[model samples]
Each structure stands twice: as C-alpha cells, then as structure tokens.
Target: MEKSTNLSTCENVMTCPIRPIGSGNEHCPYDWLAVYDGRDEHSPLIGKFCGLGKFPFSIIGTSQYMYVEFVTSPAGPLLNTGFHFNVGNWPGHVETAGIKHGVCDWLLSSDSLKDSSASEGIFLSIAHWYPPNTSCSYHIKGHVGEIVRLYFPSFRINRIESPILKYEGDCGESLTIYDSDHADPARIIKTFCDTFSRPMEKVDFVSTSPSLYVQFDSKTGSYSGSSLYYWAHYDFFNNTRFGDPVPNTLCDEVMYAWKHPGGRLRSPLNSLIFKRTGGSDVRCQYKFVTDRRLYARAIIEVNSVSFKELPYNSNACTRCHEERVDKLVIWEERDKYQNNLACFCDNIPRAVRVISSADQMNLEMIVQGQHAITSYFKNPNPLFEATYEFAHGPLCGPITLGPSPDGELVFPYKKALAMVSGPMAPPEHHYRREKCIWELKVAAQRDLWLNLEKARFADRSCDSAKIEVYLAGRLEPRFVVCPENISLARDLPILTTAELGATGADQEPLPVLIQYTGDGQPGRNIFRLVWTELFHLPRNPDGSLAASLLQDGGCDFRCPGDTEVCIPKHLLCNGIPNCPNVTHTSTLSQLTRHIEWNLEQLGLLHHAGDYQQLVLHDESPEICLKRDLSELPYGKLSLIALGLCLMFALLFAILRRMCRSSSLHQGRHHLQEDY
Candidate 1:
C-alpha cells in the first residue's frame, strides 16, 4: 500500500490478523508474511514472520510506502489460516531522526523558539521504527538559572535474554538520562532497562544544571517480540522557587538567614516537578549563615524527612548508620566535619528542634541507594524541610563582674533563668556548648581570692563542664578545675595573683578572668564562685611588719639627714642615688648607709651586696677613706693625719727659700747692665 503526499504526513503501521503455519525463524520459513520499507519488492525487507502466534501483530514502516507479500509452500501444514492486514498512519507522531552525518544525535534548545508558549513540547523514540544496533543522543539546553524537567508518559523496551543461560542478561537496550549535556557516567541521573519499564508507570527526571542529555542505545538489530519505544516531554523553567542558587554549583543553595533571619529550607528532591531516579548517589547541601555578633545561634526545626522505601520509626536516625543509606545530616558550618547534630532517615512527626553551636548551620541530603525510587507519588523521594531562625539569647557576651569587694558569681548567669523556667522553655540540650566569661578586678593594695563554693556535673568525669581561672597578663590559666576534681575544688580560696608569684607592691588594679564552659544539660552542670578582696600589706621575711622602715607613709626607701624624700622600691640600691638629702661629695656614702639599712629592715640585705659592688670599687677614694677610718684604731688614725700635715709644712718652707734666691739673681743682672 502507498500513501499519497497529502496522506503521508505521519508514520504508517501495518497490522496482520493471521497465524501462518511455519517455523518462527525468519531466514528459513516455509510459510510467512513478508514486509518491506517501500512500495515494491525492491525495497529493504523489514522483517519476515511465520508461526502460530498471537494475531494482529503490527509492524511500523520507516516511511509512507510499504509492501507486503504472503507465501506458502505446497507441503505447509493444513491447519494454516489465511492472512489479512490493515495499514494506517498516526497523524502527529514524531520519529527519532539523525540530525548530523546519519548519526542519531540532536541538540534541542528552549531558546530556539521565540514564542514562550512553544518552549515546551514532546518527542518519541519511534515515530515509525527505531533503527537497530544504533545509539541516539538528545541534548536539551536552557537559559541561565533554568533547569530542564523531563517526563516519560509511555515507555517500553524489549528484554534481551542470555543466549547460553536462557535467562535475562544485562539490559541490551536502555534509555539513560544525564544531568548535564555530556554522557559522563558521573553525570548520569537515571538509566532505564526493560525491567524498569515493565511497571508501565510514568517516570520523571530533572537536571541540576541548565542542560540535559538523553541517550537511547539499542545493542542488537533484531526484535524480541516487543516494540521498543518511549514518549517524553520536556520543559524549561526558573529554579528560584526552591532557593537561591549557590555560584559555581549545580544543586547546592545558600539560604539567607542573615538578611531574612527566618525561612524554610527544602531538599531539592522534595519538588514535585523534579524527582531523582536513583542509579547513583546525590548530595546537596543547604547552608544558613547569620551575623554572629547579632545572633548567637541558629535554630532549625525539622518539619519532615522522607527516605525512599525507608519507614518512619523512633530508631530511624540510628538505623541509617550505613554509609549507603539515604539520610539527612545536620551540623554547624564551623564544625561541619567534627560535629554532626543529627541524621534522619524517616519522617519526623514531633518536629525536632536543633540549635547550632554558632551562627552558621548546614543541612545535607544524601541519596545513595542504588535501587531507590524517588517519586512524588508511590515511592516518595528522599526529602527534608526545615525552618530556621537566628536567635539572640541572653548572656552571650563578655561580662564585668565587679568593683564590689566580695560577691558571688553563678553560671547560667541568673538572667538565663527566664529562658529555662517558663512554659516555653526549650529542652535542656538546646543549651549545649554554652560558653561564658566573667572579669573581676582586684583593687589596688588588695589581694583577690576565689572560692569555688559549688561545682556539680551530670557526668561524674566532668568532661561536660570546664572552669578555668586566668590571671592578668597570662595566656595560660592559673587554675583549671572541673567538678570531678574533688581535691582541686577543696584547695580553693586560691590567691589569684600571688599563686603566680606576682608581688602586690605595684598599686595597679589586677584583673582576674574566670571562664566557664557548660555542657547543655539543664540543671546538670552548675558553677558558683565567690570572690573576696583582702587588704594586703608588704611585710618582711623576719616576721616583722616592714612598715616600721618607712619614713614617709608606705615608702620603700627614705633619704638620710631628715630630707624627708622617699624613693620607690625599684630605686632602692640602684646605681643612681635618687635621695634628695645626699650631695655629690657624700652621695655614695649616704646612699649606701640608707640603702643598707632599708634592705636589712626589709630582710633583703643579702640582695643589697650585689648592687653595692656594682656602684662601689675598693680602690676608689671614698671607699679608701671609709676603709682607713673604719679599720685603723682612733689614736693611729690621728697620728697619721698629724704627720701628713707636718710634712706638707716642711715642703712649703723649702719652696719659699728657692723663690727668694731666684729674685736676688735677677736684681744683680739688672745692676750690671746699667754700669
């Protein structure tokens, strides 16, 4: 039968309604019905069929013209029935045609059509018939920020059986879809075989990027008692409805918690328009970040979580221990790898709330099941939806505890009581990883004392709570104590600065830092510390009050000879004499006397000798005079002084006699010149 030009606008299929009596083999059949691609016997033979089989078998032709012939041998079976067939055409069917070099490859784009209404359409694997031993690829491209959505309304492929085993082998004919325009194995979104098409259910696929690739591969050229065909529709639309796209990423997104502070986060698989056909694993991360200075923590309330074929139960999180299971994992971005807050594999009915330890939180959905079916209908896709908000809670910043002499400090600071006591109180675990710091200043001339009144922890090992005391100008803590350290707690009333060997002589205010870190179980970890200031007076090592040595009130060193000048402790025994009463001639002796007395009074005389040696040498005039006066007897010292004076007088008389003789000689020389 030949179709006219007007009637040949679509593909033609011929159906036969008779079972010929012959072997089913096509090459050597006794009785058979022959079909051709053209109007005459000279055309290519499509297939020859003969056997007792179902009637009304159909064969689709490659074009409008087709030829058919019926033949029977004289020795054919007598039970053979006569054959008759009909030829018809589908009006609007589209066939898979090669676009380049006879290769079944096509590039389809949404931008090809200017009309918005015509941006989406349908195509089929076989408008007439798919060529055998051929592979066809369709690349669908869309605009930026747009993703491709494809749906298969009808799909069927012939199942190839093993020749030796006589059972189904690997799928010889398959349809595969890639998330990107390339047929890379890693980008493959889903693959369908005869087994997957047997259910006759509609399937959906979506691309994470702006392009998608669909490939149909038929490995064998012959038919296997079934028609291999599929019908699919594709559309391109913006993906902003789900979330803002993260740059340089396909499926990942960044939810704006810093600007909006409150919003919803949904898994990409949750969308009705897009569902993952699980052949490979998929991981998409949703991130929420806030300004940590304004918000202390981000709170996430999980509305629901669904995993393919995984039932909801109390142990859902625990049951997803295997790395291959579908799960939703949550954690703070700062500690993403180290600390995962929770993992869910099933729906959460109670709306579990999780608070991040810091300002940023991340939620990742992982779909790793090789055979899991992710659809919006019968088998729900792996999905999770959560609502998040940046929270500003009390006691999140540094605090100045006191100018008061004695006061007590309690952790959970008293103000946080309101957050924990009311009917709207959050669970105790919400406060996990709480950190607080308090500063206490020790007044001048006073010592700071810290007494740990109470230290309690839920875990007796005290790993949950940590208490540290840091002294001024120190990086390392002076005291690191936990509730479990009974011996350390009993040794409290610690002298904050003195324990570090700091003398309180300098009248500067000392700052003591107390930091408390809590493990968020309410009422389980508690810390109470009382600080007291004690009047401190510098004292001598000899059990005597060193204040007796001060001429001026609280002076460390005093000038001699009633000058009333006082020097600081650092100036005492220094090389330079700073005392006002001592003169340049007597400075050394006076400074030495005063410093020696002061050092002795302060019980630091042993330390004074080292400084005195640096300032004075034994051969110096002052030292020699002092030594002579001190070592000689009183009578010998006077005789030595008198004898030295008489020697000076004899030398002066001899110098006077020499000067008189020189004057008399000059007078005689002048008299001779006059004569």
Candidate 2:
C-alpha cells in the first residue's frame, strides 16, 4: 500500500505527482519521471514530483517565466532566442494567490515569433502566478482577444491624427475613446463651455456604464437611448469629431461627449486642445470616445470673449487692499471675491453677484503661503515660506499658520471668521498684528462693562462698543497701523452694507485693520501673508468714505419658491438638461444660503461662542429677560399703576371742597331766590 506522490521543475522541464502508463500530451495527459528541490527545513521527504516517460504535469501556482516553447531549435542556431520563465518551487502544490502593489505578475516582451526556421524554435512557456493580498477564481479554460489603453497626467495632448473610431449621438450606440494633444486656444475651451451653461444643467441623464444608461441630455435628455426612454439625437453640428492619436491598448473607457457638463472623452490617437471663454454667444461644443467603437464631435466658433478684471499680482491681499483702498465698498467683488480677485487662466463659475460698497467692506485679501491648519480661519504669517515654499504652486509641500498647539494669542478655537473694518470712527485707530500696529484705544462701555471686561477685549471685538477703531492693513506691508487717519470719514458710522439692513447701527468703534505678513519677524509660516477681508465701507457724517454706494437696484429681498433654496451653481444652468428643480443653465437664487451673518464673511461656514455666548447661544437669559420684560409692560405697572391713578385724583379734590361748604350752610334757599 504505497501510493501518494509529487514533484516539479523548469529548464528542460519535468513533473510528476502519480502516474505510469503511456503518458499523453497535447496539453496534458500527465506523466514524467521525477524532480523536486527541497534543500532543508528538516527534510520530512515532504516534497515529490516523480513520473517516467508516459507524461505527467502538475504545478498549479507561484511558478512564472522560464520557457522552452516546444523547442528543438528551428531556424539555424537560436535566432534572437525567446522563452524564459524563471520562478522555482513545486511539489504537491494546489493553488494559492495574492498580489496587488504596482502589479507585475510576470511579463518580458520582445518575442520575435520563434521559428523563421531553426533560428530559434523556442518551446512553449507563458507562466503565471500572483501573490499579495490575494484573490483568484480560475476558469475560462481559454478564449482570447485583448486590447487596453490608458493615459493621463490630467490630459492635454491634442494631435496625432486618424484611424481609431467609436461614438454615436443621434440615437445610435457607440462610445469609448482616446487620442489627445490639440489646443487651439484650449484655455479650457471657454472654461469648458462657460462652466457648462444653462445655469449649469444639473443632470437629466448621464450614465457611463452605470450598469448601462446609454446616453442623455437632449436639451432635456433621457436614458437607454430613448422612444419614451430614448433619443440620443445630439447633433450640435453633424455628429462630433475632432482629430489625432491612434495607438491603443489596456482596458479602454473613453465615453466623453457633452453639450454641457464639462466635456472630454475622445481618444483613438488624439490632437486635443480648445479655449474660447464663456456664455458663448456664437458657438462651442466638444466630444470624444475612441479606441475604435468611435464617436467624435466639435464645433468651436469663438471670439466672444467674456472674462477679465483680476490683477494686482492676481490679488496679494486685494492688491494690497486695493492700494490702501479708501473707497469704502462700492460693490464689486462681483461673484465671491471677483473670481477670487484675479488669476483665472481658466475654470469659470463665479458669475454675477457684485454690488459691494462701503469702500468694499473694509477691503482685505492678501496672499503668499506656507502651511496653516486648525482649518485656517485667518492667516498671513510667512505662508509656508523659505523663498515661498515653491510659491503657491498647485504644489504639495511647505505649510504654516502659526502658534496654536496651545500657545494661543489668536485663534486656538475661533475658526477663520473674517472681519473687515473702519466704521467711520476717525481721530485714532490702528492694527497690524504680525509685527504690531495697535493704535485703537476705543472706549464705549456698557453691556455692563461687558461681563467684567476681559483685557478690554482687543481683536475678538466688543467691550464698551459701538464701533472703535485703529485700522490699517496687509500689515502696511509689514508694520505700522495708524499713520493715515485723515479723520477717517469724519466722526463715524459708514460700515454701510444695506443689501437691506445690518451694516450700521450708529457706528463708532469699528476701526478694524488686522493685515498679516511675516518674515518681518516673530513667529512664522514659511513666508506668510493671506489677509482677504475684501471691502466693508461706511463713513459719511462728513468725514468722507463713499466711493460708491447709492446704486441700490437689485435686492429688495424677494426670491423664494422663487423657495428656490440655494442658487449659485453659476446661475441655474441651461445649455441642456434640467432636473428636480434647476441645475443646468442656472436660475441663481443665492440670497446666499439663508442669510444669517451672526458672522461668516465668506470663508464658507463656521461659528463658535462668546460675544456673550454668541448672543446667548440660542437665547435664555430668561428668554432674553423675558423678551426684555415684555418691552416696558407699563414699567412693571409703574408704581402700582401710578399709585392707583394718584389715589383717584385725590378723592375728586376732596369732594369739591366738602360740597362747597354745604352750600353755604343751608342759606342756599334764600340766596337762590334773591338771585
């Protein structure tokens, strides 16, 4: 009773597990004498592969490359030889797999067809094995036809021209592509069609193999092509095709076609690049999907050009606060810091919303960089310096935002709540912070000395307060905060922001000016400086400060069901597609997400405490002193309702002086008659 066995090898190859009879082989009948490498692990003879002549083969895993490919040397003396699968270890092995880090199970390229004659009739060998994390199912005993192509560095190639195809919009059915290098002004091609217009079309239908959604956006699109759910007929102009690039391989997936919704999906060897600038008045469209299954589209017609106004070194803190911005808010951050104050090589999306005034709300915005996190609420301290940590590049290094691992001088938990200043209060006001510029000595006092005065509260605001000032910014480049107060808009009150209220309540103490910039010394964040307060103006009881405000036309409030929730996806979208209630050519509701500035001058969103627990963190100083003691309630019944109405008017004047002294003591009869 002696049966079980195993063994294997490579190099003139040999294998055996158990067999002996006329061994067969076309692919496998199994039989081959013996071979197994076991050098020592205390040798239990636990390794085997023995067979003779008749044929034997079995080495199911982890054995790659070292081929022989049915050799007997054809084309005279091994011509440029091929077949080399080098991996060793086999003997009663079943199947075990795992590997997924930079993938390379086994591959060696350069295989010139082995037999131009005995020149190199390499035997057969194409080994396989993969080990790491692990996953294996094993089947498809066989069926082959392969192709794969992948390219990206975020793409930007535009030509090579012709020969690979796939794409069909006009209700056909073909998609997938590649090919690039073409940029006829491809400045993001009018910012990808003005950032996909029609208020930024929100999505009628788009499924890129989302389990088969076919295609969509018909101006108002559909899915599975369409008849009720079909109509892939999109001809911005005779189907859609552009040029260049055609050498492909590796799991292809091109699918890019768009009337809007940011386009790009073409490749079959390509030549791509297009730039035309937004809200196209005359023409623009693009498409791609190639790797042979073809579909391409393009229609350019540009020169409309609408995108400019943004420069001051692309905004180093509002061009240094608009060169000492004196014009308090005349509205013009046009759409969230006006395309972020400048520098848009191209990416479109900040449309409209300008009107800003009051010398542009105190004006802020200055930049440089470093590394600052605590989720950065206010910055500008070396902005990750060292010769500008490679300067604000789309980069990835240098980061700084100064002192807060418990050092706390400013912001350990406040979060970037921005504040622009100068509520007209002149005579004296100053501030700089990174190098010291403190001038504002303000004194208004009374919220009962503000909970017993905390260092008279400097930059956290409010103490005696109406306004209070000491302003000047971008750190005056580095130091100095109060040297230019020409009576700062004479006397006070111009914080001015009336999109209908809340920007002035008898102004005075508001002389804010906290500009930052470092390397000017003390504490650092590489190269620091990022101010961004961007406008908040008001002053005009004669002290000057009204460069632009009386325009007043666009905002009376209204805009709701017109409930239109939150607009600003570029104005509510249009070029094509619409859904649930606007998302394509934009309808713009942005009264800016339910307005409530308990503070949030546009950093996005954040709020904490103290300003008296932030107006009593949701009220309860006894419900705001019982709603301010129900506003006067007759002054808590003013002294018993005025002492019961002055004791009923002093008892009616003592009953008219005792009834006129009893009518003159009864002599009234005689006196009446005589009268």
Each prediction's whole-model lDDT (CA): 0.59, 0.22
CA deviation > 4 Å runs, candidate 1: 1-34, 39-43, 48-56, 68-85, 90-104, 113-116, 156-168, 195-203, 222-229, 239-675
For candidate 2, the 10 contiguous residues with the lowest summed lDDT are 385-394
**Candidate 2 on 1-675: residue-level lDDT in tens?**
121211222333233233332211322222222222133333222122222232222222323222222222122221112222234553323221222223222111112211122211111111222211222111101001111111111212111111012123231211112111211232111111111222112111111110111111122111111111111110000112232222241112222322231232221111111111121121111112221111111111111112222343333224423442111111123346642222212223332111111112111112121111121212212111100000111111112222110111231112211221125322222321222111221111100000100111122222211122223222122222121331221222212223112234433333233222222111212211111111232337894544364223211111121222111121112121111111222333332222233123222123222222222111224223433444456865888888999998999989998999998877878887899
- lDDT, candidate 1, residue 393? 35
Give residue 618's lDDT in candidate 2 (0 to 100): 15
Q: How close is candidate 2 to the true structure, as a TM-score?
A: 0.18
Question: Which one is best on lDDT?
Answer: 1
For candidate 1, what is the lDDT? 0.59
Q: After the best TM-score superposition of candidate 2, give how far the Cα of residue 356 lies from its true spot, in angstroms.
A: 13
Q: Number of backbone collisions per candidate, in order? A: 0, 210
Q: Tell me how far the alpha carbon of residue 413 in candidate 1 is from the true structure, in angstroms, after superposition.
A: 36
Question: Which clashing pairs does model 1 show?
Answer: none
